[model samples]
Target chain A: MKKLSKRIIVGVLTLMLLCSSLFIPTAKASVPYDSYTYNFWLDPVESPNPYVPKDEFTGDPTTMGKFNNPQDLFITKDGIIYVADTDNNRIVFLDTSFQYIGEITTFHNGDTFNKPQGIFVTEGNHIFVADTENQRIVEFDENKQFVREILRPETELITDNTSFRPTKVVIDGAGRIYTLAIGINSGIVELNPDGTFQGFTGASEVNINPISYVWRRYFATDEQKKRMELIIPTEYNNLFLDNEEFIYVTMGNVDVKDYGIDVIRRLNPSGINVIRDFGYGSPIGDYFVRDQQDITRFNDITVTDYQVYTALDGVNGKLFTYDYDGNLLYVFGSNGARQGNFKNAVSVEQYQGTLYVLDNGNNSITSFELTEYGSLVNNAIKLHYEGKYEESAENWQQVLKFNANSDMAYIGLGKVYLRNGEYKKAMDYFKLANNRKYYSKAFTFYRRQFLGDNFGLIMTSVVIIIICILGLRVYLKTKKINVQKREVNGI
Target chain B: MSTYISTLRYSLYVIFHPFDGFWDLKREKRGSLSAALTITGILILTYVIRRQYTAFLFNTNDIKELNLILEIISVLLPFLLWCISNWCLTTLADGEGTFKDIVIATSYSLTPLVIINLPLIPLSYLFNLEEASMYYFFLTLSIIWTVGLMIFSTMITHQYTMKKTLLTIVGILIGMAVMIFIGLLFTSIIQQIIGFFYIIYKEIVFRF
Candidate 1:
């Protein structure tokens, strides 16, 4: 009996150990970026020199050849960086290695820049600078030769009375120049390729207040009505051209309560927004913030491809990166004095795998290199979009081993299973990702399979249910008749 | 205990035979005020719990910012107001039902809804995204059953025809609205009066 009890105890101890093992959480796999505090922190690459190259005129005696409140940076396809040196009134140029190439302080035709805040370079190396203080956009050819200066046109189409102070510029494929000027609520100032004023496009709709509207219509005097502010669109903060020439514009000052207007918009040729809202909640920065001032005043947007874009918010000094479907992938860069943080992040641009953020307060550009996990995610997304689902499935599974909380990995697996016609497995993965549309597609295929297999059983159950319902109804009717008959007999 | 159990059991019978069940509940003294209040309390608990515990896939409630007191008041106040408004209107219309009858009948009519919905809170957890239709169907079924039961009880309690019962139900809804408006106006006036006293008190303190 003692031996028997000893055997039972051994068995119970083994079972307990197995159950405890199941309860223990799995340790997350090591990711290169796992050491960073932010959700998608890119490691700052050690630059040979962080300052923009200066050949002739060094900056203030203490700061040396460093920048002076540079407001924007745009990297061309050939890996050339152009900096809008706003305070110094020059457009500085740099090579891929962060070494200064040259500076454009004056035009060939004797027109010098005055506080140029925005710069854009086309594929053919045509440069466009928004000379903000000069109140005109100066264009330069690939050889740094002055092409022309575009002034605000006088046309019946221009409606806003705001002064023409162009702060940003983006040229579309159709040779349309979309400019963001100070106090311009009409829309992005669209000028024809030859600098003729094109009517406003992508004008934000004015929010109507129902209570104030009724009062104003019924009670306000004519003089009071005249004094009332004209309902106009909010000014566009910045604009960028995507790979397809679609303009992505950001608005800095927007009412938090207005759900209709998004902080970021990708406008089509006709100026209608085409970005998909993935319902991952707000597609902007942090939704639940401690203070209203913490809200992001998005100043610049940089599109790597159609699939990914990053917005640099000046207010909170945060960088919010989103996928094509409007899923916020990463949020980093807090407003702080830390090395990786930005004091006043104004613009972000990408050259190859490096992201350079321009900070106005620091007067410096910071470069961040992609970690291993970032590369893995990018490769998997690229492969999946390229229709190599099976290859991408392996990468997604590897991602899950690192971060089980990744909803995109689950979506990738769902897509793989869907392509392989494994509807049931696809449904499970899509359900995990909370993707209702894909889940419904999988359910339709699963239902067809289920019904095909159990056609006989389903028909039998349906017939049986009908008969049972009818029988129950008839039985209840007879029982009622008998009870009524008994009551009549008693009376 | 037996009387309470029987009163609760009679709710099931009343749901199927609302006309006779409501009449007997009033004329035969079959229902008790305690039992009616218990049913109403259960209804409120069911609503609150359902909003909290429903599966995330089907639950649209912003659980992060949920206010328990506000949720309870939203459900309970409307119900109590409806009962009071219906009773007042019926009294003027020469309806046979008393205040107790109206409250009891209304509470009893909610049995079908509570019965269907209480079980669904747990069952929703078992359903996947595709099987969510089952949960939705039961939700809609409970609402329809309660509405049908309410109309039937109202018709029987007042001894009115179908048309008159519908019209009276509409009038009861309007009366509930008017009561709410008056309550809001009274509260606003009280707030203004308090504000006036507060200003005078501040003036006295500052001047000294």
Candidate 2:
């Protein structure tokens, strides 16, 4: 009896241990995890910020905070989330933790939203909504009270029959409002805060083919010119205001032949692109993607306080992040139906170290928190852009230890070597990263070194060739004189 | 077959000794029209294959998006137009070379391009990013050789002085431009006429 009891007790202990081992792993797996599709770097899971609809959206449409096809999300400094509940005709407000705070459903004198597609909450807590279908902008105060409505300004600069349907709006620090209205290929329509009309800003420059340019200038009659398509600027897709109040715009319809122009632009106050390129190639999209349709079409952009901004690529449903100098830091998110993937990534916003991407296809927001490697990449890129080359190189090297295929890390190391004047090493790294600009610069230095090393041999050969040429000329002249003397003596 | 082979082989010698090669190619009928056309075809084939199979580092064309027929037309149209335009202008300048001679000389001039470019296409595959300059050097060398042969053949075939040959070549370029302008005008006029009839037909049908 004593042996039987001991055996039973041992068996029960073994069973308990097995059950605990199995249950612990499942519990760990159930915890929110970060997952992102990688092109060049392996971004492991840190944590996931999975969100469900608030209590108002749980059941029926009788609640104030319910969202219907929310198209955009903007987070303020204090972490208030402003969502453009597009189909619901409201802007649902949420606190830092995504709890339903309140919403703006109606405006002045019983007017309400006519599909507000964009929402921007300024530092002073003023709300600006692109009341798109209604052809007006609704602004409200911090107290959730209706302030004033700004209609589309009638200006002489606006060509005849220009559509006033605004889709996105942004305000600069100087209280200048820029609107990207539909069918306005001219550019972003600028307006004063007091609703006065200003001119367009940062219009896409017209590209004229040289052959057709000559034909149009010299051959086409005035009547033929009238029938010709006006070489207007491409339309602006979206805009974001950076910490410096500089406007960053994304043009989705950039053609293939505009060699010098990028689809992404950081415009200064004077409407000039001021973003510098430091080893990072044009931060528009994947530069080497083979498919023409795979080119990134940025629908919206979110510029963070860290000077690292992200653009939401609608075509691929991906998020591409770049630093202030337009160096690509990381590319993550994708088009799919999984936990972190988005079907239609319409807008991306950064708040408190997490990215909240609003998906229009599924009408939900998927948030991505930075893993350890993600934070390391961000810190490395920030240091590199801050001109701390050596320190950033160390971080970039660490990143390479984790993900050897990190092209951005290779670029970082290339820039470091370039700054240190190690041209050969810089050229190797730049070639690996496929950066032609820096590669040529390094090639120039290498060429100088090669020429310096071979200067003696080159000069000797050149002198020998010159001497041989002169000797041949003299020999030919004497031979001719001999022939002439022979002829005269025979005569 | 032997004659064709000899004429094509003579093109190689023509590149080196252009004065006599082009004179015999026209006056002695050493180079035939079929041989010249074959050379033209080979040149076009080299261009198309080079674009298609050159190493990615040295190539910028998207191969998946390449339309073979359009690429061929884009090359052949300009080349044939240049030949025609040059022949027309040379005739007006009282050149001795016939239309066949001009065609044969122009096509034969492209032999150097084919000879250098065809070998370099495969050789490009062996090049690293840093060694791309070697490939580009051969490319530039071939272009210079072909242009030199073209000028030489033009001078010899037409029996013109160097200055007159240069002037006639410039005139040929101007004549090409004029041809292109007239072609575009004709296309536009044809399109407008078709559009007018289509509109009238639509109106008549809709009113009834």
Candidate 3:
């Protein structure tokens, strides 16, 4: 009886231990979507998730009502979140903790918004709403009081048949407002501080291939010519102003071959494109596509203070983040019916390393917090940009521990090694990263070192070879003379 | 064995002095068929080595996607096509070179490619991107020299004038293209026939 009781107790204890172990959570749970970045070969390589969904804001209907087809999201410097509830015809505000601060349903003199699509908040807390259907831009003060409304410009450039429906709006640091309207292919419409019309700026140039041009000019019949697509500039879908007041615009409907040109542009005050693309691949979102519909259609773009911008693709529901040099840092997100996945992601905004994507189809704001791997990469890039190579190297090493396939980390370490006069190590890292430019720079130094080390041996070999050749020639000449003398004497 | 070595060394002389070398390569039988084939094999080996061993700064080939058989075929196919096309055109143009003569002359013309590029494989490592133009200049020079040798070999081996040789070379290129087109069409037709038989077999098996 004693043996039986002991056996029962031991079995029960073992079962309990097994159950407890099962309840313990794993170190990293699987996410609903995969994160990837393009390799040097333009192939999509899987990477660790940079940002994962932390929380979502669906809003209570009893209080501010549910978010109805929200079109835009803007996070201000004060950690406030503004959502343009397009179908609700209102703008909802929330604090960083997602607490309801207030709502803006009406402005000056009984005026209201109609399908407002875009919202921008300045440093002074003033709000600029692109009241899309109302054909005007309404401005509100920091206290939520209506300051003024800028109507459509009554200029001859905008013909009478053109309907002015501004879809996106941005205000520069100098108080100049730029709005992207429907059917305005000329360029972004610029408005003065006091609501005066300025000329269009940064108009996309029409690009027609030579073969098509010759065919259309010479071989096409009248009906065929009429059926051909007209060569015209595409309209900008959304625009954002960075800290330096440069307007960053995104065009959704652009030709795949015209990716680097009109798909995304950073326009200076004078409307010149100053975007740099020193990266391996063009900043065209996706390099490999199977079909025409697989091309990335950029819906919105958000720029951070570090010049690291993330463009949101409405089609794939992915966010492509790139550095100032247009090198793609990471890509994440997808279109699915999951908690983290978006259905129709319209806008993306970054605040304090967190990304908030507004999904029109889901009618919610999904907030993503940076993972450990993500924070490491971001810190490394920031440190490198700030000229702190040593600190960046440490961060890059940490990042490599998480993702060994990260070429960015490899290149980061290569730059540091090159700076530290470690040419051989730098060359190895650059070769692994497939960065030929930096590899050449390191090879030059490596070659110089090799030649310097073997200089004495090389000189000695040259002298010895020359002396051997001379001795051989003298010996052969004497033997030839002896043979000639023997032949003459015998004759 | 001595004859083989002598004929093999004759390629070095042929590349430099095409007019006399090609004349003797056929008339005096200084060059042999085995020697010509050996040169072709070496040229193929040179291509493979250059593709794999050239410095990363100058080599643009994706190493992961490198196919050894494709590299061999890239050299061998064009070489054989040139030989066959030249033989066919020369026969019709009242030229004197036979198929063997065309093969020997064409293979001798390729000696410069092997001579220049085999050393370039290692020399590529010694230069930087800033001095890439120097490397490219030598590469271009080797190609031009080989092409010039090929033109001269054709004229001498076939005993034709410069104009006729140039015209015959143009015809050979067009002939190569036509041959490739016909080869593709033939294979595609064969595939369709096999597919038809496969479907018929499946239908018969299913019915039974």
Candidate 4:
């Protein structure tokens, strides 16, 4: 209950902070909160994340290894984990049992990596390695052996430095790969199965450092589409692969040099949906719970049915959790610069039956068996990209057969379940990824996604809360009055 | 038309007789016309004494000044008309009184447009909702004008008022509504007839 009060107080303060007239000089002002018409943050990095990356880790977050400069992480269905061991210029793969696999430093016979940033595994063992320094997406065969480049003459997708230093790789169920191409103008690049450009969702100032999957789907009716066509661009970053969906992205990592953002943004698939935003209830400056400032500085994010998890680049090798309704659940880790301490807890992945993390500090992989939040185990991204979600959750039970701890696979399944509208499964994947703080925070934000149109929902909720509070007060008052009456009657 | 000319001749005779025979009408009609025209110059000084403000209210900025001017014109012109309409009615039609009778009848005729519009204009201010609300005032004023005009017309013509005047006005409005309903019902037929003649005229002469 006290926690609830703290949340409400924080919500009000954050709103006031946003409303406070701090002049952003170069910013040409427009209506804030009206996501329908604003552009994304470009040309600058404002703040650094407070948390340091866990450069070393072993199995159970209880242990620590000795590797540093971990940038991104992903877990496969069989509980096999992959980390973009950034500084090493290599992509590392590990199994659920904390056993190591041969690292794929190059695609085929070439030094395909300058700074390897994002890694992914597709159905039938097709692995995608994003050689960011080389500015390309490389493909490998099932044996983890080298293959040729998918999209050469990067010109088609890069379109200049806007797509420089590509980040995470998100693929649709249909085997199509998308990368968060980070640059002066950041965007998610969609690739055909043959590895060519599928055009940007939409570009120009609105999309800056977009970090998520971009798809093509329609969310509004024809009449509403005609009306908003002039205002909201047609293409959207299809974050969630559902027909009427949006992919949420985390921006402003301390890993990079941008400030101001410790932020989150969502876009529709096909690109036109450019609603760059910060989290709901952006904390007022900083809230001091203890001696340290509680910063919601967010890093990587994965969506679940009942929640979304964001890795805190701050403290507690923690994954902040939120319910789908955007309620803070828990921060599932300890606070320290050691193993299990969420030291710069940078990346989280869910696979098969477990959640995985690259404890960059311990230089080892760890997995947690998934329990609650519905049947996320079986639904993989393949089901979503294929648009065969009805049968999506079916393949997971058998696939977890290969490895008991495939974090990336579980995260992929979790996303597929989310696209299929299984939010509980989504929540489980988020929790497994060690992203409880982000989960709770994003869950709280779900309430705001439709705020202007959902006044009735908020009013009902507020009225209910107020009534409960008033009812409790009245009950206490009535009991006191009865006692007083008895004393006056000399009973 | 000739009678109208004669009525004006008598009006000049009355005003000049009451005031001064400034020019010799016996010498020539032109001299009388010239003297009357010359007399208008002396009255220019009266107009110079700041025109009276009016009571008409309008919502649109474009029409506010125009409406005020129209109100001034309505008040003063009808007053002038009152002076003359009565002179014409009594001197020519009734042939009962002199210029004094004309003044009295003309004042009575002008009362409905004035008295009702005076109270009606300020009530329009209560309709504060910018443009459409002015139309509401206009509709209200028309109903008032129609009913008030009927009352004044009956009163000036029959010399009765209070209950008798209003009941008669209500009856007139009801009769007018029925006539309007009939006209509306036949409007399409009327339009067709007009179109038919226009089309025939266009086809024959205009086309050639």
Q: How do the residues B1-208 of candidate 4 rate in per-residue lDDT, one tens digit apiece?
A: 5543553344344332421211222212212232332233222222222122221223222222345445445445534543444334334432343454333323232233333444544554333223435546655664464344333433443334456546544554555556557767799789999999999998999768
Off by over 4 Å in 1: A1-64, A159-163, A222-230, A454-491, B1-21, B28-57, B60-103, B114-141, B151-208
Which of 1 and 2 is ahead in TM-score?
A: 1
What would you estimate as the lDDT of candidate 4?
Answer: 0.47
Clashes of each: 0, 0, 0, 102
Residue by residue across A1-491, what tens digits does model 1's lDDT show? 99999999999999999998887644322111212111212222111111111121223444337788888899999889899999989998877667668889977756788899999887788999999988899999999999888987778665555558899998877667889888777777789999998777888777778987887889999999899976666778888899888888888776655533587998988889887777465566666542565666788888876358778878877667777777665565566665555678788888765778888888877776665556566667768767788888998898777666566778889988988899989989987766767776777787788889999999999999999999999999999999999999995
Model 2: per-residue Cα lDDT at residue A450: 72
lDDT of residue A436 for candidate 4: 40
What tier of docking accuracy does candidate 3 attain? Answer: high
lDDT (10s digit) by residue, model 3, range A310-392? 99998899999998888898999999987888999999998899999999889989899999999999999899888899999
lDDT of 2 by residue, A164-226 (tens): 788888877777789888888777889998988988888877777888889889999999999
- Model 4 chain A scores worst on lDDT over the 10 consecutive residues at A31-40
TM-score of 3: 0.93
Please give the DockQ score of every candidate, comma-separated: 0.11, 0.05, 0.82, 0.01
Interface RMSD of each: 6.8, 7.0, 0.6, 24.6
TM-score order of candidates, best first? 3, 1, 2, 4
TM-score for chain B considered on its own, for each of the candidates: 0.96, 0.97, 0.97, 0.31
TM-score, every prediction: 0.74, 0.59, 0.93, 0.37
Which fraction of the native contacts appears in each prediction?
A: 0.00, 0.00, 0.92, 0.00
